[model samples]
Target chain A: MSQKMTRRRLLLGGAATAAVAMVKSSFGKMVQTGIPEAAMDPTRQVGPLPGVLGTRSPFEHPQRKASLTSSQTPLQDLYGIITPSDLHFERHHAGVPAIDPNTYELTIHGMVDRPTVFSLADLKRFPAVSRICFIECSGNFRKPDKETITPQDICGLTSQSEWTGVMLSTIFREVGVDPKATWFLAEGSDAAVMTRSIPVSKGWDDAMIVYAQNGEAIRPQQGYPARLLLPGWEGNTSIKWLRRIELSDGPFMTREETSKYTEPIKDGKIRQFSFTMDARSIITYPAYPVQLQKGWVEIRGIAWSGRGKITGVEISTNAGKSWQAARLQEPVMDKAHTCFRYLWQWDGDTTEIMSRAIDETGYIQPSLKELITARGIGTGYHLNPVTAWLIKRGGEVVYRPEKWK
Target chain B: MPYWACVAGIAMISCERRVNTAPTHFGYGRPATKQEIAAKAIAIRPDGKGLPAGSGTVQHGAVIYAGKCASCHGVTGTEGPFNVLVAPDTADAVPFDRAPQRIKAIGNYWPYATTVFDYVRRAMPFNAPGSLSDNEVYSLTAYLLYANKLIDSSTVMNAKTLPGVIMPARKYYVTDNRNGGDGPYE
Candidate 1:
């Protein structure tokens, strides 16, 4: 029977008769269903109206890969340099707090001529500045040993945004910061009340008190009302949920800087306050979980440096034996993620492919072996090495794991 | 006006602003009061700048540790369902190493002893953070120090004594000098 006739029959019959008919129809031959008439006729249905806010399409799904303490951005899914504010990587000591912007106040004290408290309104009144930069966690490296991992699994803790706020220097000058003050502590308002002692030079340099990200109010996970933006530094140093700035003469030696973030180097010496994120790059295309075809393939990825702009990116389709320069997307801003692409035709051969980033300072991204030899086995933080992807003859792309030691 | 004169005038004004001792400030935020600063300032420096006036003995800390910290950190503060805070006596004196058997207890990894007090007062008890009093925080610091064998069990921890108590791992801390100049170190 037709679907329309069946619906009419169900409406006409009572519960007992309908149950008998359903059983009788199931025992008979099966029938195929076709498209509904409303779908083909546009005038029969009405579309949704304009909304106050926009949302991504239901078909498109870009999600952060989360763990117990942190979540990584979907680096492979992202297209451009600026990461969507909602999809930005998050690493919080405690969980995110629900802070009310109307009642928010950021205090600046310690070793200053005049300690000051700035409201959100007052912070907005200052000369606002916007710059595109990446905030990379010092512990962003993940050694992938499986074929199921994607680019997001390898290293997705770094994210770029067009951050907008008042320059910390402007606020420092307003608060009459003393020249004798060498360092200032940035404290968060989260449950952990995270704190880090940042150098005074950074405050006077490119540091900012960011309230807006990616043309919108900062997300709660990304520190909603306000956060400190220390360009080219470790993400932890740029404290989210920034509530206080206390200038001091020396380092705070907090738990984060001491027991947590610090790592042992060669000769059993611990390296502390290693703020700057080293240059690194990962090939997003031809990554794991995505099968490749034997044809013209455009290898694409992102390369960034905390030191300066990414000058060049070298791609080696045949492993690390030889490398050729990949074309960088135009307008590669300083300390921002720069898109890179290389055109290659695969002969369906099983080989390893990787990319190395070269920064303006002439520093080449090192291999895992070289990094381990320099820092030794105990080192865990700031593990930025060239990651490789293995391409199987059957078109399966897998992560080429290296000796973490 | 002549181009040269205009350029000279602009340069003089810039120079005057730079040299001015009392420059026009941005004057955006209100001056924070002493009370306001004290209420929000919780960070303790290595030099004991923010250490409150209080003292605690290891005897008191042991009781507090058993009740509050032992559930997460082990009973002796070393055996951990969480992070290991104590190390065995047979372990290497300098525990920072590439060897497979490296123990990063408070006695071996932490560079500053005062950090224990600051961390406990700020984010301890895990469930009720920032709930510990200055005396309790100091006691916990002393207790952990004693447990790690960094200090005597009878030693009282205070602002004056905590900063002077040097950590064994303090000598191994070196400032990061990676300038992106060359290989792996960069």
Candidate 2:
């Protein structure tokens, strides 16, 4: 694999701390120091001893760009399905809260025969189930009509991880949920006390109260002690820092649901409770900020859907006139991000390239124009359009800007 | 039969415990008390199921809005550096789906009146959330509603009347229509 690697070495922790104290950047800033340029090649040198935790190479700074309410993951730098827990995109109504795992307790009440409180340890004692899935924010699409934008800047709110926990069905059984319950309110413990009314069917179907993410305790930013994980649904429904679950007969129209998540449809109506993310794909390579060479280039990207597994991904080399199927990387799990690639020999000619995901439900990823024709450009949520990149004959690549019509 | 054995592995769950038909409660947690549930039960439904018993008038709310909320929501509740709380022109008459600007606010977009109370009580004032009293939340809800012309100056916002104060935009809300198929994208 040809790595777009930055210049090297970052010394870290313990003995490196003292060594880092000696180094400064060109501007006289106290930058963490690595071995001198002479020692850059690792083949001849002995590495330092292992520490409590490992750190990424100092040169590799794959990070999330943070905003007031959300952060975008650096999609171009990632490999495979599982997103590094730290690099996972975050969307929170309130900032991450510090909660002690020992004191963490989840209260399940309302419309249940036996309202109960389970400590974190008590929860782990129940049957554990782990599954890999992608959690994409319904509002992951952002096309600002800029050609200089990277794939990370376009749609980086989606991320994947193998979450481990006890199923909500097991918890419901433990609490003896009432038969009349059709909906349940999931409440977070953050300052906003963020709440969402979820269908009871979702709980019985595939919901979980997850504590471990990608194998370890979930990071505080991703909800420390525990969170509610609803596979294939929008990220907002998976209430982080989950504190309470109240079963009810109808939906509780909270501010997030009514004022925020709802989208404007074709008519004068507002579409509420639109939870699933549509099938979408974007070619990371040969995309903006990544200049390309003429010969053999493999187009690579990720495709996922809330409905089911990604069945196929069609690649268009000449701006959507015709298409060919890309190779789907194996171990394609349900409702998870699946990688796709296609080999192409560029002839040093200026052209546009794009990819569209087709899910098991046979839902083909639509273009920005089609999305606007169907849902209108009024609502800024649930947009998953076929993204294209304009490859210049001079080996420069840029995003083909699509205006929100 | 070993219940733990059946629950240990997802692949090894063929044990009769999986077919208990009626699941045996694992008894992992203790019964929650009413106080425990009520302490964190702050969410208010559209039907006012969880609305607190306090009351506030538009006049009283204006005072609270000026002191605590005006810094972030603007003194008039319309010009916001963050989110505009009031927009009277874009009320029930405006078809948001086709509107030119599509500037949504509490009056034109929000469907539930109780949400004002619920949201303010949980997250408001910007500097310090969940710091508002029940009376203060009611006052702010009334003040914002009054500013949006959704309620009269004399109208009191409380448990009994909050739910009955039907929002104009409530009629336009519908459940999701997209069923993910070969059909057209809705």
| Model number with the top lDDT | 2
- Name model 1 segments beyond 4 Å from true: A1-44, B1-24, B89-95, B183-186
Q: Spell out the clash pairs found in candidate 2.
A: none
lDDT computed for candidate 2: 0.86
- Tens digits of per-residue lDDT for model 1 on A48-92? 233345445323668898987899999999997889987899999
Which regions of candidate 2 fall more than 4 Å away from where they truly are? A1-34, A38-45, B1-23
Task: Provide the lowest-lDDT 10-residue window in model 2 chain B.
Answer: B14-23
Each prediction's RMSD to truth: 8.3, 5.6
What is the CAPRI rating of model 2's predicted complex?
medium
DockQ of each: 0.63, 0.67
Residues B83-146, candidate 1: write the lDDT tens digits. Answer: 8888664224544546635768788778889899988888888789988889999999999999
Structure candidate 1, residue pairs in collision: none
- Candidate of highest TM-score: 2
Tens digits of per-residue lDDT for model 2, B1-186 = 487765676555556566755445888889899997888788898889998788998998999889988888787977777798997575566576677466788888899898888888888866899898899888889989989888899999889989888688888899998888889888
